[model samples]
Target: MILDRQLLLSNAQALTTGTVFSTNTIDLASARDIGIGDNLELFIRVIAPLTGGTSVQFAYVTSANADLSSPSIIVQTPPVPAASLVAGSEWLRVQVPALSDTTSRQRYIGVQYTINGTFTVGTVTAGLTLDREGLAVYPSGLNTAGF
Candidate 1:
């Protein structure tokens, strides 16, 4: 759950009707190449409590242009309930697909949010992370203890 500013997409962005592109777009062709390789995850958290809204849809987009005009959708999340969006909670997490993933990636990577209904109060913060260790802690099977 480590957040990096350089990899940040949105910063407490206020959700409104229509679509809004993230403030930052990551350039994979650059020297840093933040979102590349086989395993990468984008973490989104609700920095401000959401109220008076129907839902919001999140998606990662890629494009050769920095403006992200008519960008190809990389991956998207289903519409999320406004009630579930609270401060200090995860709104959504997107796993950066490989170059050969279902959608595929471009030279630049960015994020976008679409507000479905009227949102009187809502904001989100997002960024990419290199760690997947946090997701591997779930215990899904019974332990074999000399059974």
Candidate 2:
């Protein structure tokens, strides 16, 4: 068994008020072909000095292309608390639910966030963890083979 944890978004991403930040799109089919299983989870962390009425939310989006349109929010965190911002890093973890039977199912997956109101300088990061099941063969010494 192999474990794969991919960082979809790094810490360099800055939040913009009234704007949305989206991570790179992931090709689920290719990921599965490369031994990534259907079971997946998202880990999100945010650090910011947010004032009252300032809110942040995380969601999963599926699109045919990188330019997402009419996106559907699969899962999201509750609005960030104004007091929590001063406490420390706000974290959220969610499991990806079963996909639909349509062609868009498991096609492209990505993380997106929306920020509102005034926010102090901060960074956000998100990652996807995939559990790979099966033997990892290697043609060369110490190197794992493709699934």
Candidate 1 deviant stretches above 4 angstroms: 33-38, 101-103, 132-147
Q: Per-residue alpha-carbon lDDT of model 2 for 6-102, expressed as tens digits?
A: 4464344566576464555666656345324566666665645545447777677676655455566667777775556543463556666666666
Best lDDT among the predictions, by candidate number: 1
Report the alpha-carbon TM-score of model 1 versus the true structure: 0.78
* Candidate 1 local lDDT, 3-91, one digit each (tens): 67888988888887778788888887789756445367887788888788788888888887787777898778899888777897775
Clashes of 1: 0
Tell me each candidate's TM-score. Answer: 0.78, 0.65
Error of 1 at 47 (Å): 0.8
**Clash totals for all candidate models:** 0, 0
Off-target runs (Cα >4 Å) in candidate 2 are 1-7, 29-35, 47-53, 86-90, 103-106, 130-147
After superposition on all C-alphas, the RMSD of every candidate to the true structure, in Å, is 4.5, 12.0
